[model samples]
Target: MRQVPTPFPLSQRIPEETAFDRRELAAILSLYGRMVAAGEWRDYAISHLREVAVFSIFRRTAENPIYRVEKRPRLRQKQGMYAVIGPEGQVLRRGHDLPMVLRVLERRLIRSVD
Candidate 1:
């Protein structure tokens, strides 16, 4: 009889945690919904890395992200915890509160219909 190979032990695996909490996701999704309704955004991608978490927004699935929302726990003490980056690699906004930090993107939702 052939024996099945066992997987590696848990101790040898990498360990990591997500940066954003449920509340943070809720706030981001809320804004995303609004932007989607306005036809401003089409898709989004999320990545949780060892040092930071990023929420990337794209106008199309095949295109590059237009905005990125990031969370860096290490920056919590110096420059708050959250940051919003534009397509040009500029720091649009940064603050301790996720919602407040995201408000910079929300401002783009405004339009004057003449």
Candidate 2:
């Protein structure tokens, strides 16, 4: 039998999907749990795509997500891999560190009551 060349090299292959690992999820969930307890967020969705992974926070089931946290490895060098986007599609924060990027959202949790 003749040898057949593979489309991709053995050393390198296309990423099937990008996902959050246990540690990353733990951090995100910690924040999520706090928001849930604060009654600010009600639901959430997670998406793993070839280029990016997203964790979306929703205030209700039917409406759009209030916030979207994304991980883009491509931007790891220039803009960092982590980002938090607001509902209006604005980049609320971006950084190499997940906790730092998430601080923008955490600020909303802080409010004094009369």
Candidate 3:
């Protein structure tokens, strides 16, 4: 009989740290909460990958995500670190400052007073 080989452990392949920090989360979640209260958003998800971290927002559980806030460390030097992508895969904004990048989404909160 032939012997079988066991697979390696998962932890060994993962990195030690994440790209997004507490300050970034705070800024993102703060806006998210406000949008939620406004009834513009309902669900959200977070993903930390080897190259990037993504915060996805959805209007409903079954529907596709409305926006994706991504943090890519590699792009920090080139096109800033934070980026907000629309549902259609277009970049709404990209900047080094998290709060500034997020401002693009906040603009949607405005409405005509008339």
Candidate of highest lDDT: 2
- Measured with C-alpha atoms, the lDDT of residue 65 in candidate 1 is 96
Each candidate structure's TM-score, on Cα atoms with residue i matched to residue i, is 0.84, 0.92, 0.84
Write down the lDDT that model 3 would get: 0.91
Q: Give the clashing pairs for model 1.
A: none
What is the lDDT of every predicted structure here? 0.92, 0.95, 0.91
Scored against the true structure, residue 58 in model 1 reaches a CA lDDT of 98
| Global fold similarity of model 2 (TM-score) | 0.92
Model 1, residue 43: displacement in angstroms? Answer: 0.3
The alpha-carbon lDDT assigned to residue 4 of candidate 1 equals: 100
Winner on lDDT (1 vs 3): 1
Ten residues in sequence with the least summed lDDT for candidate 3: 11-20
lDDT of 2 by residue, 1-114 (tens): 999985878668768999999989999999999999999999999999999999999999899999999999889999999999999999999999999999999999999988
Ranking by TM-score: 2, 1, 3
Candidates in descending lDDT order: 2, 1, 3
Where in model 2 is the C-alpha error above 4 Å?
A: 1-3
